[model samples]
Target: MKLLFKSTLVLFTTALLSQAFAKTTICYKKDWNSPATIEVEKLEGGECKGELSYRDMLKNGWFLKDIKIEKGKDGLNYIYTLTDKRVVEIDNATILKNEYKKLDYRPFAIKILNVTDETATINVGNLRVGQSGIVQHYYEDNKTLIVSNAYVTSSNETASTLKFFPFTDLKQNAIPTSNRKPVTGDVIIMNYMYDSSLIIAPSQDAFSATREKYKDNNFLHSDLFAAKLKSEGIPTPPKEVIQEYAISQNLGTIFFIIDNTIYVVDSKTFAILDKDIISYNYIENKRMPFYTRVEKIEKNIFTSMLDYKSWFGFLNKIFGDDTRSEDERLLENEIAAGELTVKGEVYNNYYETMLGIKK
Candidate 1:
């Protein structure tokens, strides 16, 4: 009799708790492009009388997309639809009307659909041929850490593919073994430039296409840097431990080539500064070693951060003698010396992020 009473008491408590934590079945989509899925969301405390709010969804990085009511045997079923975000697609007419200029240079949030040994396919619909970014994974605590660098070699209207590379030291001849690889559902911050002096490609074949043009360039090659790291002792460091070390040697500007296009991205703001498409043709109606015509069409995107003078200096350094005016050199020195007043908030934010100085 005593054993029976004890068992009954335990069962009663468990039932009461279950009733108190009862949830409403809700409909949700992981992203806008995803299919609707069903989930049971916990109701608030206090006799289980509280209702779900939009604030609760926002707290979990979700937004209310729609709500529906359907008649059921239990009386009425309430289906609440939610999505990660509301994405408004850019129409072709708007793009043709120069309305793309109104869009801000915000980091694109993309989800990994599939993964492989060296690459991952993403759900991002519009990625330029040479665009790059960083892949990250969120922990249970909601904090996200960088996993690898991602580069786009090809993209279309619905899906895009990315190649992954490990984070490496800019000045060292060593590549630390990456402890993590991108898996499905990992988030990618697309077009987020990690450093200014870095030039990245998805593979050796992609890099070889533009190798002849940049033979005299002083840019850091991601593949060569990774090779150097392999030659050194393979040291696998934690993600947080490698954050500062990965960025300490950055000089500030990113250049990447995909096929015939070269893209320039500003490391400070992670914004694309320019795109140049190289066209080749035979001169004098005949193919000759000395008569091959290589022409370039430059898209001059003038911004306050990257003025024509800065662009000229960048070109000169890569193609010319790397000479800088005294004023420019002094400004750079001031920036390196932590004089925030010299370059304003843009440079200050850049330095803060570059040095991993959290606010």
Candidate 2:
């Protein structure tokens, strides 16, 4: 009876804690059982606006002091500036269009629908650019897709790529040189010079079209995964114990782990994907022995740390023999240093994440 009572009390306490931390669940999914109660009010100018105020946000456990509400530059979507590391940029949100132009669409993360060698279809997202010139991949509800005729190719090992015409450009202007066909054997060389232009090398050896099954669909589903972990008594893993992490795009989850516990987050929603208690490497660090006393510093320590024995060493010695500027040499030196540092990194595949996302 005592054991039963203890368990019941623990469960009750956990329930209360969890309820206090419930967020405003804006249902972007195709189906939702209980969505957030969104209040809409009519303005004097006959416009309707959403009512996600500071008080409503605090109920979701968000520290309202860090949130700054601002209007989107496109005048369509509202910006909820958050300081936490959460990827709130990509949330599906309601749009209030104060500035609307005929066919005026804001920059957005393109929702790829189909990209075959013969045709391509995509739904452009409503993008918000921050003051720091960073593009937020979030989208408003009033997004529409555009289809263009194109060709797709596949490559081996290096990477795959998709090429399509800018629908807005094609709609506004006429271009005769836009439909240039790629060469058969060349690898696609990508160059990002501007916001609207995506440079692709015309070749089959370097790039390939995205697979058919992965196209026209949302693959990363973090929120659905988070709901699975909503039960009480879930364990929180240590942050430093995450020695390795990677975006398992094929699996639609961001994998977090090293030797013991593995956390898989939904790539789209940034929600914890694992449905069980996660354990950290509590024993790995202590498995080694410590010295009884301090040891003498060996000359090999400097040799190992500063030895550019590989190509980096050679490059560091003779970086600017050519006509390269000081800035260029410095950039190359930094790259070399980074490459050296990565050799000692505990995690190898950290860059494989979606913009190296941290949870």
Candidate 3:
């Protein structure tokens, strides 16, 4: 009888320890910015106690602030504060024993689309199921994302388009003539020169064609002026005021007086195209003769002329000059002239006319 009683006591102790060793639920606070403390204890048979610091507790996402473990009449009572500012207490033991692993994967694909001289559009698609956020990709070598500012459209298709503004450094290399040898007839070469300064390469075909077209298009001439006024949105000034502004900007002086309005056409295109009234006002002081600034006036006059081949060739010439000093005055002058000519012509002619100004 004594042996049986001893055997029964041992068996009971073993069973209790086994139950106490079962998995305990780990609890943790999700807040990473703040720290919290944690405590662990055995509930059933043996008395096992442990305390976890906030930093260590973070690894398991469980933070216990004020913790206590005690054996009561009911069972093992584990009590703790979460430092979450809330007073809620968790009682599950299974949460402590579970192990977690992180999962990560590349969730999208990148597709390059048409790259124009000014812009590039790329398509990004196949986002992870149900995941939504700005898609980002890092260029490892550059240590930067190839592009950001990606916007997602709600077309139910998982695709997004990203427009990339090419870095300034890449612009030169991307030019069509970057790898080509210098050729006289090459449009790129012509563009290079034309872009530098208003060096008019008088190609017979281009010059005649441009001249003839403008002469026949009377509406186009008036449209140009009207467009400028519309774009400026300021009330039309008197003829004197208009002339002064144009001359100050080196655009050219007013020539023919049409119905109280002075008509000033870009010099290069003047003979070819009808005059565009740059300003309309009563004549004031005629200190500067209209022909005094004829060169500038002529340059301004034809600045709006569009010869794609010539323009491209001009750009190539400017960029191809490796021996030119960085601070060369001539180059600077050329660039300034080119900029003024191109912008003035395009703005005054095509764009303004498009906005509707009747000749």
Candidate 4:
């Protein structure tokens, strides 16, 4: 026999606000697919005054699902919904875990079976084509360092081939400093292979300079999307959900702006790779906009941060020879020419699929 109990926890703040009330409802099950237990928590304040905050949920694996705020004649009603969802971690990459309240995705780990010019083959059977992951190499120093990002171009039961985007070392002025390379023992880890980046700002006005600087570049903007959700009468999602949504769009970098500073963070590990500080001043008590100073910032900031460069030159220095034929140099051609296909869609060549010429 199974005994289930419903509990309500009421935490009161020191002072009440305008006679309003706030409530938090948690619906979760101890086991997957089991009957959910609803726990209701109420606070006696309009502003949702309580010591229980969002970050507190992480300890017990509870995550915010959604929230609702309603205005009442007395004051307001704050409704917070949460759930207990599992979070998956990969290579210590917290992008998924940090951004999604419930980290329910499975982690994919694969070994580098072989490495060639700008490409590496991994022993992956479940990774989908176009999925990306961080590539870490085990160095002789006993430290595993992230050397590059890899994306699956083709995969099968036997093996999955990945194209490498070697991280550039500006300090060493090398493609991947210290002569480290992806070896047979290195690992490719995927919580999910993120592709693009998400930039969060106070508003478009706050990001105007970076926007004009990278006019051709495309990235997900947080404020814009939130406003769209608001316009559609949809409540804004939790911060973690917002970032998780960005990951769904394949955004690998998640960063934000505070005042005049731009923090470029790695979406996977949430590490601040670089920071951009815009110079400005108050001219006679009126803030003066310095567009010229903004231009002085790196024009190729995004390119330098996100773009993939040819590590073939560096590979040649170590391996010494262009043994790969012209046909193999191009990844798309190689994928289409071979038995590799994404989602069971076979293509004679990449162009035929791109041009919509079905065979």
Among all candidates shown, the one with the greatest TM-score: 1
lDDT of 4 by residue, 232-350 (tens): 33221233445445655666655454446564444533433345665333122111111111111111223232122232342233334766444335523422232211211111122
Cα TM-score of candidate 3: 0.14
* 1-359 per-residue lDDT for model 2 (tens digits): 33543453354345334433332222111111221321111111000123344334433444311111122222211112211223232221211112222221122232333434322333322221110011112226744222331212222233233443222212211111222222232222121111121101111111112112113323223222222222211111112111111121222233333233333333323333231223332332210001011121112222334333432343344443575455445533433332212120112123212223323
Candidate 4 or 2, higher TM-score? 4
Listed per model in order, the count of residue pairs whose N, CA or C atoms clash below 3 Å is 4, 8, 43, 4
TM-score of each: 0.30, 0.18, 0.14, 0.30
In terms of TM-score, which candidate is stronger, 1 or 4?
1
Judge candidate 3 at residue 251 and give its lDDT.
34
Residue pair clashes in candidate 2: 117-151, 117-152, 153-208, 154-208, 186-203, 187-206, 189-201, 222-266
lDDT values for all models: 0.42, 0.25, 0.27, 0.41
Which residue pairs does candidate 1 place in steric collision?
Answer: 174-229, 175-229, 196-252, 196-253
Each prediction's RMSD to truth: 22.7, 24.5, 32.2, 25.2
lDDT of 1 by residue, 197-225 (tens): 55543333444444555454445555444
Model 3 error, position 172 (Å): 4.5
Which 10 successive residues of model 1 have the least lDDT summed?
Answer: 284-293
